[model samples]
Target: MQDGSDWYGAATATFGDRVAGAREALGMTQPELAERLGVRIKTVRGWENDTAEPRANKLQMLSGILGVSLTWLLNGEGDGLDQPAGEAGARLPEIRTLLSELRDIRADVDNAAERLARMENRLIEALTEGRVE
Candidate 1:
């Protein structure tokens, strides 16, 4: 599995198979990849076991970290690992930083949406109770 040819076959590989193959090709342990992605090791295990899939943002980060295209990561059919390991490592810091910012922005948006929902509920209750008249 170290060479990424382990997945070559007539049948289409599952998402987990691609993930495991790519990680193995990169010589990355599950723990190492999880730490780089800022996720728990169990999360990586879940992905590799086909028990879970990463969120879109995490998938993007995983692609970058694994030096494979997102399409390849998902379906195993695309430009996979065109870059050497050193080149991939060179781009990792930038990609990680951008991903972190995106995550923070997403969190803020979620919090704002929650607050708006609460406010809307309060307004609806007040109106229905004749308190807003």
Candidate 2:
């Protein structure tokens, strides 16, 4: 005798169900998850519908992004939304690292833009100071 409650558990849930559960448990929308994964919304939809499966690289990234183990994401056997509190805390380090990297990249771009502006100003000054040949 089995009640339908099992359907909601990872043990009997479909792949799509697990994906959607993890995404929601992380407080992420489909679009946000897709953007983080660098995938199209349609691709995400396909995955959630069980029409497709992510490749190994994407699977690894998906697990990390969703703060779940690969096995849990695949078969609901390891660690899924069953432990939401711990999962959320586990993702902090990765998020912090990503934020730091983005800050470094932004700084590099700003420095390059400033150097380009200075070069342009120097060129303009030289052109205005000299007579045309």
Candidate 3:
């Protein structure tokens, strides 16, 4: 049987920092997550502060609710908060190509955001008094 300390270790090792980080990453507060899990806010706080450990069933529920793999939630491997080890014999060219494409898309999105920001600023200035130079 898994002891409380074991559960605590797994939660800390997998989550690092604190369970709050994982909860926050999923855009949930203690009350919000507690509602989702049908638990009390204090239970969530205990998990975050390491004041108590979750049972196995709760851990599994948390893994699913938090949108992380069970293995990752337990072991902190395979796309956990940290990056996993590279697959063996993976070609560097493929990674480079994907990275280049991602960068190009990011640049396009950034340009669009900048243009939107400028337009919004101009609109605000026009409403306030004069055109934004």
Candidate 4:
């Protein structure tokens, strides 16, 4: 950290940030990673969104699958992907903002889907009860 070469250093990147970066660097989608790690897609989503984390066994498997050290994924202090250079590096913050926005949208979609399921169940009950006109 002295030379400041690590863009996603321990001070800046969270566990989720490192996990997402490593996954993206390997060209893997959340579903793909989740399947490989034998977890649900939402589990992967939760990990990336910082809403949840994996267990120790899953963490080890994740590091192997993503080609990053467990230490780096945990603290961004070991062997890990380098941040893009020059122009790309300049856009890193912008990229992060967009990713944040996308994650928000994903949450909205999940919420909406859950609401739809509840509504559908209610409608089914209403029909069975002869409440609908």
Q: Over the stretch 3-122, how does candidate 2's per-residue lDDT look in tens digits?
A: 222332445456776787788877999899999999997678667766679999999999899877788777777666653345544674575466446545655665677799999999
lDDT of 4 by residue, 1-133 (tens): 1222256677766788788888888899999999999999989988987778899999999989988887888888777878767886778778768877887887788778889999999999988999655
Query: Which window of ten consecutive residues has the lowest lDDT sum in model 3?
Result: 1-10
- TM-score-better candidate, 2 vs 3: 2
- lDDT of each model, Cα atoms only? 0.70, 0.71, 0.58, 0.81
Query: Could you give me the TM-score of model 3 versus the true structure?
Result: 0.46
Q: Candidates' TM-scores?
A: 0.54, 0.55, 0.46, 0.78
Q: Tell me the deviation in Å of residue 24 in model 1.
A: 0.8
Candidate 1: worst 10 consecutive residues by lDDT?
Answer: 1-10
- Which pairs in model 1 have colliding backbones? none
User: Which one wins by lDDT: 1 or 4?
Assistant: 4
Which predicted model would earn the best lDDT? 4
Better of 1 and 2 by TM-score: 2
For model 3, the superposed segments whose C-alpha errors exceed 4 Å read 1-18, 82-133
